[model samples]
Target: MQPQFQSMQTTGSIAVGQNRVLRNTYLMLAVSMVPTLIGALVGIQMRFSFFAGSPLVSFLVFMGVAWGFMWGIEKNKNSGLGVALLLGFTFFMGLMLSRVLQVALGFSNGGSIIAMAAGGTAATFFVLSSIAATTKRDFSGMSSFLTVGAIVLLLAIVANIFLQIPGLYLAISAGIALLSAAWMLYDIQNIVRGGETNYVSASLSVYLNLYNLFVSLINLLMALTGQRE
Candidate 1:
């Protein structure tokens, strides 16, 4: 009887811990958005360009820098430094987004399109998160599949950079949007099920999911509906 009671207590403690992590993650995710917004606004005004001469080189450099930041954030996830690094990474991502935003804004209804993309992305996140939180279904099986899909998508994106095929570009954008949504669900479920115990890492995962979702949605929308200026 005493052993059973101890097991119950252990389970209860884990539940409480998971709840705290989830709450903190949501708070940090919200706070992270402010810096991203600021970065995007400044990026648009300044017309930031990573490298004007070579798109492929710029992309490779950007990926290297992004990976470096992710490694730093993971290494410092237990400290305050992790939060700072995460915010800095989001700011850099916003700056990276400016080029796409600039392109979207070149259309006659660019603002509307951007708003729609944001709204759609938010809807996707809210729906997926809700399902993950409320449902008892385990999404653990998706982890491996999604990881493979992401790798393939990344390779496709890199290839299209040189191929410059419009059809493939559209397909890649759609694939990213789908994968981002799935990842949001998986990440949230992982948090809820005590699979992920760290708020910092969880917040980073969710933020990246939302970031990719927004970017992909915007690309799809602009490609299909954008009215050129």
Candidate 2:
């Protein structure tokens, strides 16, 4: 009876710890959005572009810089520096997003299209997150499949840049949006199940998922319904 009681206590403690981590993760995720918005506003004003001449070069440079930031964030995940680096990364992402946002804004109904994309992304996140939190389903099995899908999506995107194929670009955007939604579900479940313990890392994972989802959704909307000015 004593052993069983002790086991119960241990489990209870673990549950509390996981709950704390998950709560902090959510808080950090919310806070990170501020920097993203600020960066986007500034980027729009500056009209920043990573490259003016070479699309392939711009893509490669952006990937290198992004991976470097991710590595630094991972190395510092347990410290305050991780939070700083994560916010910085999001800022960079927002600046990157300006390119798409600028193009979207060129449409006659650009504002409406952007708002619709944002609303759709929020709805997707809320639904997936609620399901992960309330249901007993384990999404661990999705990790490998999502990873493979992401890799394929990345390759398709890079190829499309060079091929300049409109059809493939739209298809890749749709694929990315679906994969991002799946990733968000998987990530939230991981946090709920205590599979991920670090809030910094968790925030980064979830933020990337949402960022990708938003970007992809905007691309799809532009392709499907954007009205040319």
So what's the TM-score on candidate 1?
Answer: 0.97
lDDT of 2 by residue, 168-202 (tens): 98899899899999999999999998999999999
Estimate every model's Cα lDDT from 0 to 1: 0.94, 0.91
Query: Candidate 1 residues 141-208, lDDT tens each?
Result: 99999999999999998898899999999999999999999999999999999999999999999999
Root mean square deviation (Cα) for candidate 2: 1.0
Instruction: Provide the TM-score for each candidate, comma-separated.
Output: 0.97, 0.97
Angstrom error at residue 209, model 2: 0.5
